[model samples]
Target: TILLGITKASLATDSFLSAASFQETARVLTDAAIEGKQDSLAGLKENVIIGKLIPAATGLPRYRQLTVAVEGYKAREVDELDIAAS
Candidate 1:
């Protein structure tokens, strides 16, 4: 999706997965994991998340600009969130 969006300014692949999709897919995959199915479903999920889905979902021009603008805010928030634990 990121490649598509960058190359063509649009997505070519379907990215209809949502919270419900995650829950359902995770439920099934967890069952598979428990049964020792040994497929790379977890890896597939991670690849989808980090490789394509997250960037596309948050990579719109406006959000990209906002991300640049608010990066410090986020960093400060993260520092605050982690300070107590650390």
Candidate 2:
């Protein structure tokens, strides 16, 4: 398994919003804007950042139904993800 420091791992996340909010705020946001990146808010951090409820099913067995906002969320994917920069 590859070992990555927490900061490194967070920085490497696919969601630019999560990365920008976590650390290196300016750089991450700048890079994301330049690249026209879109955040899917698929992870816990991303949801927390947007004040959205966590999906019931994140495919991680350990986190089943942690704080699901919508019932039956597992049946369909969220069509929209909030990507507002903080």
Candidate 3:
């Protein structure tokens, strides 16, 4: 039971930043550096640490490749939009 708890805590996060704030500061950083580890956005804490919103049920990074083509509508720059709005 004790071993299970230990394993659970260790496996909860592989983030060096999180671990650094936790117990094994040097060991975690050393292991990560020696292994040439790059931080990933695969975990919730990583996203939170970087100030990024979590991916909701919307399954978004939404609108990244969104390009709208309107028939008979000429697309103008943002500056033009301000002038036109005025």
Candidate 4:
């Protein structure tokens, strides 16, 4: 029935919009089924559907932290009037 609804919705309009709506519907249905219980890490859709951590980024074992350089040159302050006069 869910698949049928999704198929109909997809056919009725754009597939992308239908897909997003279907995902949201699936999430609501799944949440209702589990009665607000936490979802275990499973499929990508399930993780995303239930708002659990996705199986990418930090979930991966080989993930590395990125270091950013904070040091940079400071800009000199100039008056707007001086620039306009020039």
TM-score of every candidate? 0.21, 0.57, 0.45, 0.26
Residue 25 miss distance in model 3 (angstroms): 2.8
Candidate 4 differs from the real structure by a C-alpha RMSD in angstroms, to one decimal, of: 14.2
Off by over 4 Å in 1: 1-23, 40-46, 50-86
Better of 1 and 2 by TM-score: 2
Model 2 ranges with Cα > 4 A deviation? 57-86
Note each model's CA RMSD in angstroms: 12.2, 9.3, 8.2, 14.2
Tens-digit lDDT string for candidate 1 (1-86): 23433423312213322221444556555655576653232333444554432234343334433424354455323332242244
Candidate 2 structure, TM-score to reference: 0.57
- Candidate no. 3 TM-score: 0.45
Arrange candidates by TM-score, descending.
2, 3, 4, 1
Q: lDDT of all the models against the reference? A: 0.37, 0.72, 0.59, 0.47
Question: What is the model-wide C-alpha lDDT for candidate 3?
Answer: 0.59
Instruction: List candidate 3 segments past 4 Å from native.
Output: 1-3, 6-8, 11-21, 57-59, 63-86
Better of 2 and 3 by TM-score: 2
Error of 3 at 78 (Å): 13
Clashing residue pairs in candidate 1 (N, C-alpha, C atoms within 3 angstroms): none
lDDT of 2 by residue, 34-65 (tens): 99999987877787777775654543445533
Model 4 spans > 4 angstroms off: 1-40, 61-86
Candidate 4 lDDT, 1-86, residue by residue in tens: 35456555543432222344555667544645566544344545555554544466654434323333456955455443333344
Sort the candidates on lDDT, descending order.
Answer: 2, 3, 4, 1
lDDT of 2 at 64: 39
